[model samples]
Target: MDTASTNHSPHLHVLHDVLTAATYEASSAMSVWTGGKISLTLDCVREVPLESISEEFDLGMEPLTMVVLTIDGDAGGTMILTFDEENGRGLAASLFKQEVSTDPEWTETEKSALMETGNILGCAYFNAIARLVQAEFVPSPPAFLQDYGPCVLEQALMLQAQCSYDVLICQTTFLKGEEKLNWHILFIPNPKIGDALQSAQ
Candidate 1:
């Protein structure tokens, strides 16, 4: 195992520039989806212990709307997109072009909207990475859930636990026109990707 690849900080240091470069592609991807201009930027990224995942988002015990995507390939892992109630509803409403339901339960339309958003975001990153690593990266259909933030992260982390003690996490901010979407994507890459990334360099 490469210590540099599994370290708690620099594990993603190599990715900062790569992700920054991919920002344009990600933004373009979203813009096409929304049928208008959209900007997506990588806010921050780092490697952290399995248990410390929730700390990155300053999440408490609050339940959150989550969309989980499993990236399957030679090197694969999970990507989790999460938002609190206010932001989640706001996003759903934006896509619906109308007010969404106020009930705690998410309607089928709401679930589909969220999943499609997650899929778009996940594929943008995966597509960029695949080009760099020269490997096909496919994401499963996003799984929608409403649960405690930590609980959602736990399920995502479980997928990568066998790959490494420290997981690489990235935070992305997306905006549609002047509206800054308060949504986030937490990426946990499989350790096997270290080879692909390193070889690319």
Candidate 2:
């Protein structure tokens, strides 16, 4: 499992295709689920050293909400859905058909709604992975956290960090009513899966 030290297969194009397709599905699914109320535009998916994730998201010390789901079966890793407190509440309000609140504390109802939203998004990408790789990719029950984005990301990366110092992250920006909402989805691929993806090419 020492993926960091192992020599990776020279199959960049194939790996790129896999990431591209999966991310596209994730964005599309989100759009459909929102009934076009929210539109998602994604930047290119990129792999960077784990330490850089905090800076990549500009995750300062401010508290934010994060939902995590673990991918199992083939290449195992985690997926993170993040939203700042304001946007998180806004999303929850929209889901519940209620007005957005300014309260910083999340009620139980809001937390549940956010977790379900995460599950939907996570399943979209997992479905793409399963279809492309022709292998079972099961997503675990979602876990919710409210903390500094960087702090929450550190927890998400802790297990993956054991096998590799680098991780793959894809960022998607969500727009509502022509205004971009502060929401992001990050995909962290397991090193073994990373190897599989490249070698499959």
Candidate 3:
């Protein structure tokens, strides 16, 4: 496979359209909630080598909360969305209007909100693709990780290992008020799906 050229797969165009729609939706939602406008930037989407995925984990510490949405295809890979604990808490506090104390009892609520927020954003993106491709796609229930450290990477690695050497990574940034939130969306296509995408071009 020509990895270099595949990096710019046509699927990226579809991905971009979905991201644009999602950004609009995210901005509208945030504006209504915060009384401030929100904007989003599409950072990048590319084919990432497996080794690099491991390196990213080594550089970052966990007790990270990540959400994974799996796509079933011959090219199966995990899509992960990551956020900082402090940022996550801040957003939750702003939305709920309650102090998000570090109490374990309230952890569930915090986790739920995080997952729900991701779902809304993901749906906006995924729904766009579904419309463009004229196919129905369903994302799995989100999986949450509260532990900080290499464990976060472990989960990602486990998910990636089920597929090939390359996975599509989509990076996005959301700005609300003066704060910026980073979102990373991975598209791991199984062998067949990957070949399909590659063949389309």
Q: Against the true structure, what is every candidate's RMSD?
A: 4.7, 5.4, 5.0
Between candidates 1 and 3, which one is better according to TM-score? Answer: 1
Alpha-carbon shift of residue 198 in model 2 (angstroms): 2.2
User: Given candidate 2, what's the lDDT at residue 49?
Assistant: 82
Every candidate's lDDT: 0.72, 0.71, 0.57
- In order of TM-score, best first, we have 2, 1, 3
lDDT of 1 by residue, 67-174 (tens): 989887546767888888887787777777878569977788888988898888778777777787777876798899888878777766675677777767777777
Q: After superposing candidate 2, which stretches have Cα over 4 Å from the reference?
A: 1-15
Can you write out model 3's per-residue Cα lDDT over 94-175, one digit (the tens) per residue?
A: 6677886776444777777767766665666665555554557787777765565345555555544666666555556667
How far does residue 25 in candidate 1 sit from its true spot (Å)? 2.0
lDDT of 3: 0.57
For model 2 the local lDDT of residue 76 reads 66
TM-score, candidate number 2: 0.83
Off by over 4 Å in 1: 1-11, 35-38, 176-180
Name the TM-score of candidate 3: 0.72
